[model samples]
Target: MTGNGGGAGPARLGWLDALRGVAALVVVFDHSSATLLADFRRELMPEFNTSRFGIMVFFLVSGYIVPASLERRGCVRTFWIGRVFRVYPLWAVVVATVLGLGLCGVVEIRDFGGQSAVTVAVAHVTMLQELLGTPSLLLVLWTLSYEMAFYLLVVALFTVRLHRRSATIAVTLAVLAAASVAAGAALPASALSDRVGTGPLILVGASVMVVAICCASATSPVLRLFGGVLGALPALVLVPFNGTVPLWEGLVILAVMFLGTAVHRAEHGQGTWWRAAGTAVVVVGCAVGSAYRYGDGELFTRRGWIAAFLAAVLTFGAGLAWRRRQLPLPLTGLGTISYSVYLVHPVLLAVIDGTVGRARRDDPALEAAFFAVLLPLCVLTHRWVEVPGQAWGRRLASGPRRKPVGGPERPLLPFRRPCERTRRWYP
Candidate 1:
């Protein structure tokens, strides 16, 4: 997102915006169909949740974009301050609103408890609710938990003199990842239980992959070639996933991260083909996933053919837009606000489900219409409540001397004045 030349502001990757918006919509559709597509949304949306895909897009984008932001500002302290401000404040609003709505009978509460409330309070405020456990207010927040982990790792990477020595970081990460895999293999049954799980192993793999990509960028020849392939190899493996979906889901997320790194390394205004290919794969992946989840198993069958057609059509549409440099503003805006939107919207829909709606199962049209209404309400919430609160948080984080985005908007990630000498040094 940063430009090292002439103090230019970071550029938003248009395709990522497009991806976020699409992911949000897919999640919305999945939730909306909870009333209509009982086999799909409620019973198996997790199995088929492109929401996770959206989250992957988000985390990967965060991993790349936030670093770019750090480069622009040239300080980790400011970077963390801004990142925290961006996520948490708006999240606080969501928690309070959901709890308030539930307590007032505006929404229904499930598993409400002191522990539930307190745990979520502590975990979310720290941005660890997803990592530590499930969220109390909303179900979609686990992605944020992993995202926060990645952010922490990035901070560590930048702080340890590792960024300046990409090769060392790569070697360290690679060794750790290999050791983790071995440890997972060697762990006693007691440690391998669901309670203990493979999180360390997964994280290790991720760390190695990140270092390798960064190292490849700095080097060339064999490492670069292998790293280049890895960059989107994860995505290619996972996006069009089917069969035993949960395992593949985890793999898909890793893929999204690799792909995101690839996106970050791309020169500004370069690789129209990469964006086209990536977006197209995601759309097609969703379609194939939908078919796999709800349709007959045979690929040559009518339903399978239809799924292929749907995916192909989506691919064509995305490709056309990518080629034309035409982007959907609403989608991009949703993408911008999407992490908040995804986290908050499901709780809102859950309320609607428990209300007069009563989770209608007979009518796809009515359910779809409900989403039409609910998603916008969530967006309105993003605009009025979440956005403003985040602004305040950023202001608190950045402090005075920074300009507000609007008359009343606040800054996050405050920076010390950059002397001309500092700018010259980086460039």
Candidate 2:
């Protein structure tokens, strides 16, 4: 979730920023604990599942803001342009750094399990490598696959005039998720890869994604609609079959995201509070039910999953309650650089794991030291990398808007009655 800040608009939502900051730290802890606090992590993971908790909060924030961004811009081309610039520059830099490290033997990269470099590169370029059965260079990038899927779905709903039905969409996805669990598994892991072959699926999915984004951003309405649907079809096909996660949980992820959108709609007077509340209940219930039915996986406990899911919902609700109030600058500042924090910490952790190795026992001091180094680096990256990239996006999007006589030039995305409550918060 990001906006063109060069467009004069409403005050930023500090609460969302605070939430992102909190989630980023939690995610950092979730990963760092493995190396620095292994014993404590073992004790806590089966009960809390910190990773799920952190990611769900992020998905909620993304749900709350992303559609509003598209609606604000009212031009698919500019929206796509904003998204590419917001995400890719830092991502490219990070990937290059990882490759460089791998080359120089500073850190080892993940084995792609027989995937050709060309196929892996194509899948990663689409950012759907996780779904297409290509291993992520950075393990955290699996979540981005889903985030990209969500973006396509959001654009599809928007183009079809169904964006306002967030509550209904949330409930429907939840119900489908519950049903998937009840019906038993439809496919094994990487089902699409098994059927179509991983390399071919990667090529096809990547091609579709590129075409969809380009066509959706086109000026023609028919192309836009076709592109939106084209983008959505891979997600619809992959989540229930080829996903790395269980079918039900993958669906639940989408449901939770729509649930966040419903909350945003309620906040902005586009929908009633009751609708949002009801959607939350249904989505949460279905998610819990699915977890119970699916039982525990090899790596995660059902109890942990259920607890984390519930806690994430409660945490989001708490944030929404305080949305109108000012948040502390430290928290908001952390949120402002949360994206860098999320992406960079893993690279740092990889370097640490490779060089220093894990502690023989739980070491809180080492974890603290990791953060002390990581946060300042994130601040620097956010300032130099993200800010400049986004500014370039704004300039690209705002190409030559007309000025009125003796007045300021209009924004590229003309202002509709803005929804102050729906300010974009990047993941």
Most TM-score-accurate candidate? 2
RMSD of 1: 10.9
User: Tens digits of per-residue lDDT for model 2 on 1-427?
Assistant: 2322223232457778888888899999999999999999999988999999999999998888877777766666777778888988888889999999999999999999988889989899888888998889998899888888988998887766778888898899899999987888656779889888998898788889889988877656688789988988988888777899888888999988889889888987899999898899999989998898888333254888889889999998999888778778898888888889989999999999888898999988999999999999999989999999998987887776443445543344322322222221111
lDDT digits (tens) for residues 1-427 of candidate 1: 1101112321335555665666667666666566556655544443344444444445445543565555565544445556655666667677788878878887776662334344445545545444333233576655654455445444444433233232233233323333333333222222221243334323433544465445433323344344434533322321212111333233333334433433444433323545535543553354345334333445443353343234424432453347337577776666666665576667767676767765445576776676667667767767776667556655654554544233643223332223111121111
Error of 2 at 39 (Å): 0.4
Q: In candidate 2, which residue pairs get closer than 3 Å at backbone N, Cα or C atoms, i.e. clash?
A: none
For each candidate, C-alpha RMSD in Å?
A: 10.9, 4.7
Question: TM-scores across all candidates?
Answer: 0.60, 0.92
For each candidate, the alpha-carbon lDDT, in order, equals 0.47, 0.83
Error of 1 at 396 (Å): 4.0
Clashing pairs in 1: 234-255, 235-255, 394-411
Query: In model 1, what lDDT does residue 96 have?
Result: 81
